[model samples]
Structures are given as C-alpha cells and as structure tokens.
Target: MTLKQDTTSITTSISNPTLLAKVDQLRDLNIGQHVPLPQLVVVGDQSSGKSSLLESLSGVPFPKDQNLCTRHATQITSRRDKDECVHVRIIPGPRASEDHKKQVEAFQTKVSSASEFRDKFVDILKKANEKMGLRTDLSSGHGGAIFSEDVLKIEVHGPREDYLTIIDVPGIFRTTVHGTTKDDMVMVKNLVKRYIRDDRTIILAVLPSNVDIATQEILELAEEYDKNGKRTLGVLTKPDLVMEPTMRASVCDLVMGQKRPLTLGYFLVQNRSSDDGVKTVSELDQGLRIQPWSDLPKDRVGILALKEQLQSLLLDITRREFPKLVQDVASQIRQCTVELNKLGPSRQDEREQRSFLSRMAGIFQDRARAGLAADYNAHSSFNQTDLRLITHVVNLTDVFNADFQRLAHSRHFSSLEESQPLESPEPSDAGDRSESQSGLSVDTLRVLLEESGVDKISPKEQMELAEILVLPKDIPMPNEGFTDWIKEVYLQFRGLELGTFNPNLLSVAFTEQSRKWGDMTRIYMSRIIVTVHRFIAATLRSICPEEPTRIQLWAEILEGLLDCYRKAMAQADMLIQVQQRKQPYTLNRQFAADLSKSRGHRITALLRPKAKEDRRFAEPQYMVNLDDIAEAAEGKHNTELLQEEIHDILHAYYNLALDRYIDNIFQLAVDHSLLHGPDSPLKVFTQDWVLNLEARQLEDIAGETISEKKRRSRLSKKITDLHNALKILKSRDSY
Candidate 1:
C-alpha cells in the first residue's frame, strides 16, 4: 500500500483493507498499550481445539499434545504481500521491569521463507517461553511462571495472506492440572477476561463437537461481554471424535444454528488426524462428509470456508471501528500536547528560570485583572463563583451595609401611629365614610341617657357628645416611654443653660449606637480577605498547572497579599475610632435637613389635637404669634419638647454617619487598599516582582528536579508515539 492522501477525506474516511492495515500498523506502534484496537481474540476451555483453529486459519503448526498446552497469549498478524516473510518478537507486559523489557525486545528473528517456517517456528516458541519465564521442562525441578501476561507476537507476510490480526490466549481452566499451580488457573482466566472485556475485540469461542456445547465456559463469558452475540463467532472442532448418532445430531444442530445461536454462527472443521496424518483441505472435507455433516450446509463445514468467514468478519469490524479509533488517537494527542505545553520549556539555568517566572507572572496578572474586573469572557474560570472577585466583594459589602443599617442602632425608632377618626355624616357626603366606620350610634346613646334618669338632650348634640367621648386618647408621644433614659443621659452631660444641654451627650449616644461596628467590621474584613484568597488561588492554578511550581508560587506570594489585607483592616479600624471615640462631626447637608424634618413632624403633632374627621393627618397651619410662642416656651411641657429635640439631633447625625462609614469601609479599606490599583493585592505577582527575586529563589521556584526531568522525557516520548499514530491514520494508502 502507498501512503498519500488529500487532507479533508483522510481525516474522515478510509477504505476497508487499508483501515484493517491501519489497525495492524497502529498495533505495531504499540498504541494498543495505550488504547484498545479492533481485532479477533480467540478463547475457549483447555483441550477445546483453540490452537487447532488458529493453526488451520494461519497455516501454522501449533503444538496440540495431550500433556502440553498454550501457557501465554500469542499474537499473530497476517498481511498480504508479494515477498514471503515471518518475524517473531516478545512484547512485555505493563508490570515488567525496564530491564526485562530490554531483555525481551532482543528476542526478534526473521524467517527466511514462510513455506519453510515450521521447523524454525517451534524452536522460536520454545525461546519465547523461556523469555517469559514459562517452564519448558515439565518433569524438571526448575520452577517458572504458570501463566504470563507477556505476549509472543508473530508477523507473517505471504502471497495468500489475508489482512487479519488474531490473538490466541491460554484456554480457561477451572482446576489445576499437570505441573500448573492453583494460581495458574486464576491467572489464565484473568488474562482471557482482560482481552475479551474490550468492546473492540471479537471473541472467537472454540468448542469441541465431542463435548457438551452447553457446558463450555468460554461461550458463557462471550455472552457476558456480547449480550446479543454480536461480536462472538462459534467454531466447532474435533467433529470426527463425535461418533455417536445423538452426538452427530447435536453437532449438526449447532452448525445449522438450531441451538445456542450466535450472530456470526458456528463453523464445523476437522483437523489433521493423528492416524493417517491427512494435511490437505480435500482430506479434511472428506472426514466431515458423514451422515449429519453431509446433510449440513456445504459452506459451514470446512477449513476453507472458516478462513473466508474470519477474513470477512475482520474486515467488517475494521470498517465499523476505524473512524472511532482515529478520533480516539487524535483526542489523546491533543490532551498530551496541552499537558506538555503546561510543563513548558526547560529551565536549566538561572536566566531561564527567571524568564519562566516572568512569563508565569504575566499570565497571573492578566487572569487576576480579568477576575477582579468581572470580565468573564477573558477566561472560563472567571465565570465560576469562587473566582468572581468583584461579584463576591460587592455582595459581601451589600450584606455588611444591610447588617449595619439594621443592627447598629442602640434604640429602635417608633413609627407614628395615625388615628383613624370617625366622621359624622356630612350633609352631602353622608354615610360615605360613616357607613364604613364602627362607632357609638345615636339610638344607643339616647338609651344610656334615659337609663341614667337624667334630662334627655337634643338628638344631634347627644350623638355629637357620644362621638366626642368615644374618640381615642390623644396619640402618645413616640419616645415618651424612653424619656427616663433620655433625661438621665441629658443630666449627665448638663451645662449652665436651662433647656440646652452639652453636645457631649450626642457623641456618647452615638458611641454606644455604633458599638457593634468594630466586631462587624472585623468579620466583614475577614470575609473579604477570604474571598480574595480564593480568587488568587484559582488564578494561580489556572496559570500554573504543574503542582510543585504552583505550590512554590503560592508559598511566596500569599503572605504578601495577606499583609496587604492586614494593613487595609488596620486602616478600617482607624476610621472606626475616628467616628466612634472622637466628638461626632459631619459637613453633610442631609444632617440639617433630617433634623429639621423630624422637629417639624413632632411640632405638628403637638400643636394640633386629633381632629374628628382628619383621617389623612394633614399638616397643621403655622402662624407666627409672639404671645403663643412665649406661652409654649414657659409652659410645663417645655422640658419634654427639649428632650425630643435632643433625641432628633442625635438620630439625624447617626443616619448621616452610618452611610459615610459603610462607604469608607468598602472603598478606602477594601477596594482601594486591597483589591484595586498598582500597589493592590491583585498586583502582587508582576514581572517586576520576579526581577527583584534572588537567583537562588528563582531556581527554587522554577527549576526542574530529577523526577521532573524524567517525567518530561517520558511524556515527550509518549507524545511522539501518539503523533505518529495520528499520521498513520491520516496518511493515504493504496492496496
């Protein structure tokens, strides 16, 4: 075949025989060690003619004696070629040591001619057994492995070759026999399962016609892996040994697919006999031309038909599985390439190490900026909640603001309860509101006057006096219940003035109101630090996938970021001390407006009594009168009014200060000092930072160790092999 192709169709399609050869080529590349490849795997119980079937198909002489059995798996690859050749070698198992692999790989030999391979092949099998540590002398005291996972690979080329690959494993055995130990039985079954479990493998279940077909273990296992018998092919051997009429009928039933049906049904074949030693297809067919066999289909009873069937089956599976195999190989190449890129170029010296650090620092800065800015499109990780620094910080500040607003106050403000006045029906709007109101009626009032044995008043006046007597008590002052406490605080900070008090009372009250700020701010600052910590950790992992290097960077960079957070927290505490411990002060205009607004509401409630029909609580009209003002100032209620004014002033200042402090904590403390700008925590990893590091520190951070060097070498070799495998799939071939 010639390897040349157009790029488009090469990736998407391949011809049947070429695809089959592609699988063989990949197997030769040892890609099967990394991924499953499509092939036929022959399996059966011991003495079930597994080796005999392989011999008939490959035209190889397999030893089938009463005392000897296959100890390890043998992989035979046959390809059609003009020149005849046979090459044999050993492929070590995964558990084999490096020294053992080198030892086994040297057992390669090329046969001069396929026609003259019988004598050399037997000697080669013996040498292969020795290499795998399988005992050659069953009678000798030299002990060896009962079963080996290592494979003996035989590649053959001849004019009559079919594009096929077959693996013949040691047959399953339920009990120990001959010189084999109990462990041998378990190892053999396990080896069979490892091959058959792969979905790409077609199971060749070899059954002897002389034994009960229902008693075979290999068919049961095939059913386990291939529930619908899709990939299982049944081969019936030793038909000549079944002499009885019933046994003959049973073999005929299986061959006709009347019992234990398989998707790729049974084939009956006769091996070269021990008596006459017949070795030709005609002689083998003559042995099967008996009562039941003669009546069976002509195509299902000979070695020639079995060979054609296997070749067709192998071709069909290759066509079905080649596309997926190519995809798997390509996908593995991409994954390995990404991992190799992550490891990056070697850092052999101080200059290279420093360069590596500088590059990584740049990546860190970019990702950190993107995360802090909430620019999720920059990296997929920015969309993740843990790495969303801006979103988390904003949400934390919102919660902090809400908690401060709700819990930072020393006393709760009472909402004014408006009185619902009952309106006596007006002349035109009669019963509009009175019908909805429930109050004393005129008839009940008159009955009460009569029962008191007093003179009866006029009906209208009686109703009016009854409504006036039933009017709810004047709406009480909002903080009248807290007056005692207010008086105590006022007296403690009293000055020489009669009604005015020292401003120290307002400051002390504010200090108590904001007592929880310190503890709450500490917790809030701690949560912000944690949020930044998680974001930085995620960013580092994204930029540096290698574990050792990431760990070193984390150890170097995290402490400096934490120190920044500590400084930011110290700044926040200083602001709290300025607001709480010092005399309260603010230039905000909202304080004056809020104080005026509160006093106006209180004065309106005090000046106007509850009106009978004033349900809207309308503002009372203000009239400037010197006499009325003098009377109010000298009245008995003046002290209470003064107390209310002081309370209003303190409350207004508290509202103004609350908003300012929350903003300062978020901006000055968290956003400015810790998260944003050139000297912020996000700027901790930079090219400048790397340049300042000493040579030893740079080496410690980025230098490769011995194990790391070995890993890099191993990955480089694996990536090379995978790339070659992809080229094999994409390269065009002409048969």
Candidate 2:
C-alpha cells in the first residue's frame, strides 16, 4: 500500500528489490534446506521455438509480447520462495570456485569459436548441467547438439527457496561451435558431471514437437541422461506443430522406449496460442495439459512422455531422493573444500569469502521479519510456524556456515604462489600447457588475474578465487523480486477452495496433484500480490516492474509459475497417498491429472486457408510451409475454446465466493459487530459489501470507455486546429 519514498538508489524500482538480497535469500533458503531450484533447461537452435516452449512452460506471451526470454543459458527458476518474479540473466561470467580455471577454459573455447558470444555464455551452464549428468542435450539450434561443460546456477521462489534447478541450455548447433545432441541419458550424465553436485537437480530437456524420438538426440539424451540409464520423459513442445493423436502416442512410445512402469510422460503446451489475455489463476491452470498418450495430439506425444517421466521422477525425488539430496549437496560442498585443496591450495583462506549463510544473515533477518509481518495471520496454522521458519533459517546458516565460509574466502588464500615459475619442458610437453597436471604457470595465472582487474592479488590468490565468479558469468536479473525473506500474501484474505484444500494453503506443498488449483490461486492471488510486491520491492531495492502493459507482463509471469505448480502437481496418485498418510486432503493431490482430455482444436470454415503468408507471422517467408500449419490445425478448434473455459471457471469461482461473502456479511451484521474501528472482520466485510453494492459507480466508469459523440467532436476540432497550424508554419517557412 505504501509507495517508495527513498530515491537514493536509482536502480531500485517498483519491481525487483536488490540483486544481493535475492542471492542472499537464495543462499539462506538453500542453506536452510531449500536449495537448488530445479530447472527445465530448454535448449534448441534460434527460432526453433525454444523461446516459444519456454514461454509455454513459463506462461509468458514470449515472442508476441516480449523480447527473447533468454539471451544466454537463461533459466526460469520458479518463484518458490514467495513474491518472486520470473527472472532472466544473461550469463556474464562463469562461477567463482577453486575449479574456476576449468570453467574459464571451457568458456574461453566457446567464446573463441562461437558465432555469438552469448552462445558461449550458454555453454557454461550447459556444461555445468552436463557435469551433473542429467539429460540436458535437447538444445534447439541446428537440430539437437551436445553442450560442452559450462557453469550453471539457478534459484527459485515459491513456498520455499530450495527446489530443483532446471537449466535452459543454449539452442544448439546453429554454428559449428556447438557440437551435437545426445540422448536424455547422455544429457543426464553431462548434467551430473557438471552441475548436479548431488541428487537435488533434475534436467527437463525440451524437444520440438515437430521432431520425433528418431532424432538421435531425443532418444539418446534419454538413454544417456535417465536415472540408472533409464529413458527420460519427453516434453512435446508446440503441439500446434502436430495434430494426430495416433502419431503423438507413437512418438511417446518411441521416445519412452520399453521401461517398466513407463519412464516418461508427455505434456501439450501452447504458450504461443494464448491469444486472449489471462487475469485470474483459473485461467493459468486451464492451459496446462498433463494427460495420457492416447489423449494427446501427435506433436504433444513427446511432451506427454516427458510429463510422465517427470511425474514419476518427481515422486521418486520427493520420496526416495529428497532426503539424500540434503546430505549429498552438503557432502559435495565439503568435497569442494577438498577439491580446492587438492587442485590448488593446502588450506582455505576463510576470510574475504565468508560463508554464504554467514554473509547473508543480516539480509535474511530483515527480510524474514518483514515477510512475517506482511504474511501474518492469526487463524492460520502456519502462524505458529513462523518461529519454526526462522529457526529453519538459523539452522541452515549453521549447517552450511562452515562449508560456505571455507569456500567463500578461498581467494584470501592461494592455490599456488603467484611467482611459482613453470619448469621448462620439451617442445612436445610445451604443446600440452592446458593438459599439464599443475595447470597454467603462476605467471600466467597472475597475468590472467591482472587482466581481470586483480593486479593487487597473486596467482595463488587468483586460484583461491571462487570458480563460480571467474569469467563473464550470467548477470543476475534486475532486483525486482529478489528478497532475503519472502512474505507471500495470497490475495484472497478469506481462503478460497479450488478443490478439497484451501487454495491458499494448498500452494505450500509442491505436489503434482494440487497444481491445477494452485495454478488458479496463483493467478487470482497475483492480482493483489504483484501490486503490493512491486510497491515494497521498489522501496527495498533496485529495479521496478516498469512496463507499459502491466497485465501482459503479469500474465507472462503468472503463467510460468502456474506451469511450475501444475508440473509439480502432475503426479496425483503418489501425492494423494502421501497426503492421506501424512496430513490433510489437498486440492492438487486430490484432483490433478484426473482427465485425459485436450483443448480439442477444430478448424472452422471461416478460418482463412494458409497462404504463403502465414497469418501468424506478419510477413511470409518464401519457404513457408503452409501444409505444416494447416495439418497442425486439422481437427483442433484452433479457436478460443480454452479461454472460454477459463472464463467460465473464473466466474464460477467468483460465484462460489459470493455465497460465502453474503453469508459472512449477514452473520457480522446480526452480531452487531460493526463499529468505529480501523481493523475488524465485520468492518472489513461491511466495507466490501458496500463496494460490491456500487454497481452504479462501475457503470459510471464503464460509460467513459467509448463516449464517441464527445470524443469525436474534440478530435475533429483538434484536427482543424492542427491543419491551421500547419498552414501558418508553411507560410512562415515561405516568408
């Protein structure tokens, strides 16, 4: 409600708060056991609908309404912490760590041979994901291509900060620099090799719907990337490219292979097809389709396969792997200390680089306190959970403080002496400088450090520098939504039920079942959350949610988070089992993936035939494939049926809420609760009732929309005056 009064910091706007704040929060949540916002790294060549798929997955209008969602290996980490924005960063440098040299070498090679510097930047994350050994090979450019090792980092905000990290690798092979695409299995292998320090991360490699499993990368990435070498689920992006359900199913089978209990599932996405604007949460959910192979069109069969694979994986991760990830990433961080010592120095500096958790404490406390205040609720069960949340924050700081501290200040110590002279060797050995066991010479390290603006530091000190910050790594997003403590305030003060669970409450648990309701609530809640979030975010930090079209921007962001919720809730059977066994009956767990249906696109007679000029594109490419689009649209109602459904769903929700509203208002009135007070449930309800009663006021506002008679008269007069002015100007010029 309060706008920013502070103007000292120029970057602080009504969008993002601060970059450091976001990182600090990410670190705290991560340390506090919420780490690794798993990302679905969608990789492909330029214009291969990589952006389109991301847009669909992220629910952003993308190409139609915004610029490239990615400039590098950009990741869309879900807003898992709280009021978070869909942030994108062009990787400006590699990560700073003891192993930073390896990252630098990989990026340098990508930069030297690449057609675009940005692709090299993307290579860093792709390589990092590859190292983690996940199926991340489904890059978009020049068909599928393999991503050489690169550094990748992703953070998300929702109910928590710690989640999976899905990386969007560079669309591949557009140039000779990017190599080739591998199967999911290979992608997984590479991802594990590079980024997945533990079991916490999963790679969701995106493939074109037009392409099939026969594409070596599609099949191979799964083969190589799958857990225990099992196949991966496929995400058949752009279902509009294919229409036949039979073909879609076949593709699903072909990509899924012969895995027991099926290793994959597909999902149909049309992020680009969001023709009408979406304002409410229900609309966001009506768009995601996580159904069976038989139910999907030929193009989405791949997506369906991917969805199934992911669903099963999600269940496995939540059940079997989650606990282990906590242990593993921690172990890996410890191992990083060992790696730092083994690779470079005998001891960590433990000075300049404080533990991530330690450096972030102040930021965390400020955010936590603020978040608690904003999200305070006397009746909710979680009201008592705040102390626990704060405790979790402190506990996390403790768990990783030692490990992070050791790693953070590694630079204050040196891996090797700056002046350590290289032993002169034979010509044959001289050619292998990079392959040398000791790495580049101290002089070389010092020179490199100096070039990077560290002349005051020694080569040993440079080596001590964090590998995550070495080269031009991805730039952090503008601090619009980043905060140390996230206070998520669901817009509906009185919780609304999308299904069995209170939509507000159901949002906390990340399951595949509650996703639908979660989707609906997210959008509906966003209308209020984003407004307040922007106001506070600006006051707090840098970057504001400054855009000409606020609704479209919101729709774009809400759409993406909505996708994540649905994806998380896609596995209903397991979620239901877990909830019934553990706690309450939640919406997603109760009703996700209950139907195997489609938006059912149908071509109408009035629909113009596809000519050389595809109406979708303003201009016709000489090599336009009219049959492809026409065949794609075949029986599909390529119409606004989905939007219509969303409209119905929203009004239904409003109608349902209206009943409760009326009853509550009547109850308060009977109790004689209305009084002169600033804060009271009865008073608030009375005010709301009055606002609702102002139908006449709404009419007055609506009446101004067209007012053609007066508007036209004013415009006509202005035009005459303008004509006269032009004449006078012309005369003056002549004189």
Across 336-428, the per-residue lDDT of candidate 2 in tens digits comes to: 444333222111222211222122233333443444345434223333322222222222223222222222110111111122311211222
TM-score for all models, in order of appearance: 0.63, 0.29
Off by over 4 Å in 1: 1-17, 31-38, 64-68, 94-100, 137-143, 160-164, 197-202, 273-278, 289-292, 320-363, 367-558, 572-672, 676-679, 684-723
Taken over the whole model, the C-alpha lDDT of each candidate is 0.73, 0.33
* lDDT (Cα, tens digit) per residue for candidate 1, span 398-468: 55564566555555443322332211111222222231112434334334423432233346324423321
Of candidate 2, the 10-residue stretch with the lowest lDDT total is 408-417
